[model samples]
Target: MSNQKIYQYLMAFGHFCSDINQTALTALLPFLIAIHHYDYTTAAMLVLVANMVSSVVQPLFGHLADKFNWVWIVPVGLLLAGGGIAATGYTSDFWQLCLAVMISGIGIAMFHPQAAKLVNLASGLHNRGTALSIFAFGGSTGAAMGPILITASIALFGVQGTLTFLLIELLACLMIGRYYRALTELNGGSIKAKQANAQATQQDQWGAFSVLCVVMFGRSIIYYGLNTFLALYWINVLGTTETVGNTMLSIYYTIGAICTLFGGKLADKFGARNVLKCGFAVLFPSIALLAMTGNELFASALLLPMGAAIHIVYSPTVVLGQQYLPNRIGFASGITLGLAISIGGITAPILGKIADIYGLTTALYSVALVPLVGAFLLAKPKD
Candidate 1:
């Protein structure tokens, strides 16, 4: 393969490693609830804490990435991400668990902006959507695998099985370290060169970006809602085994991973805004049906369309965000990849509360409404 392809794959591998830890936390939630006797809101708060920290720090990290070449953050962040989740197994208090999760969140925050900045530089303009989709695919696949890995680990070693993430991350760090020089070389030169080039280009379109943010925010809520509760929905509402519920979750993410790549190619062909509109259009009905359905076979069948609708917009949004703010690619990436996405986690507790007071079915129905709003926003004249 060419150096560019190799570098993209390497970065994608890093993305996979980083995201596994993020999803690992989600996968661990049921176990946490069962083992610790925690309520729904308390368990969801773990996601909140992680996303809150990531949402707060990712922009700062992205700003730093814009100013300097922070290539070293990748491996360091991977280590911390893996290590933090591993520490979760050992925590004795709620505060301690939150602290460990916070560390993982920070590590995740550190990885995205810099890594995405490098991916953008490597892909250039023509194949950006495809390249980013590949990168996103890796994370999505890792997300798919996370539940299986964690659940299998727990089956074998109990909660302490989270330590497996530490070993996996260490291996990823060493691999990335080995390729450290190649990664910098892919940057084409110093951050100053990139900044100078950006300055000479089209200006940032704040209005368009604001609209994109709304689109992304809606997508985030739906994505996190399904991700956080799908397994529980299977277990609690559908009367499936935990193993079966998590397996369905794995299938959901695996389908999303495949669609993520397909979505990028579609974006390249049809235009990002069109792809964004198409995704939300499909998403609204899919989620609405998913909420309304009670049959296990039917719910499982819906995952295919639901996964496609949610992930089809993934790379397109990221690419458009970068295109909209050409001069602030890293910062844009931080917002698109980190902050806008994680902001949904801020609502996790609220969803948890809804689930607590009403039901998971009602909470999911609420999630279905978000995409309708996104579709309305998308129907507006181009910004």
Candidate 2:
């Protein structure tokens, strides 16, 4: 059997590949609009297709992972995700584009809960928060790379440039597939690991988890808001070119990626609940202040605090959800990592409609207030 560290890193690698594809779609939206002449609502619907489908189905995948040996999800999901983006460059039809993105979303849905369950079992209780954070870092890194890869590809080869990235995901899939047993070993190889899984009490706390889901849904709104609208805000509100807009986005993603690492470590040291509270405390004000900025440089710089505040809870909330439902790790992960995020993704269209009707500044400020709605929910203990 391979060491737990190998399995941990391997899972993180798969996460990287999975999210790189997921965010690549987001990164490509400007190109899609510029080239195809799509409206904000149409473009936003593409995201809704990619993320909502995954959001709705992820719990099923999680339940399957909990009930059976479904480790195949890791590699297969990577291929589906990257494959969808690769396919994106080949089509121009709106409906066809939606199909491709939805497929990619399905791939994302297949990966997270199962992978998270493995990470939980691998780390044991004492370090589980940090372990999950490390796992989350992989996805954040992929999110960081997605915009750069897709944009560079387009800059060089037009829309078809996204196809070049397929090789990266393909290589990762084969590697993960080849070592499938390593993933299985994560839950059972060591006596301690077995003990850790056993120690997880079966008492499920649905009420607390439901409240946590609402809080997470609010976080997702801010996250999806930035991912979906930040570029457009650069263009429409700040008068930056698409190139500069994407560059700012790339910076936002990269900073968020680095912060995920520290977010995990902080959760381990300060406790997930404390980290979560502090994160939201910072998020509410930072996001509100971001809406009031007008200078392009200052608006872009504002994303740093926004990214830190949003990402700080990425791992902690997942860990806290698990604590709330010790016996339902897969379900908890599904809600924390998948469904709540999807809820936010699904809301993009509504915001897009608002942007269409009311103007971009109003839409931006509206989303900034979403974090404040959930600040009270975290007042209770996370664990």
The numbered model that scores best in lDDT is: 1
Candidate 2 local lDDT, 20-113, one digit each (tens): 8767887888889888998999999999999889998998888887777678887777778888888899998999899999888888889898
Tens digits of per-residue lDDT, candidate 1, 1-383, equal 87677778888888888888877888888889988999889999999999999989999988888887678988888888999999998876999999999999999999989898888877756688999999888888888888999999889997888899989888888888887887776554543366447554777888888888887888888888998999999999999988998999999999998999987888788878888888888987888898899999999999999998888888888888887888788899999998888889889999999999999999999999998876445332223
Stretches off by above 4 angstroms in model 1 are 188-199, 375-383
TM-score versus the correct structure, for each prediction: 0.95, 0.95
Clashes per prediction? 0, 0
Candidate 1 residue-wise lDDT at 302: 95
Candidate 1 differs from the real structure by a C-alpha RMSD in angstroms, to one decimal, of: 2.2
RMSD of 2: 2.0
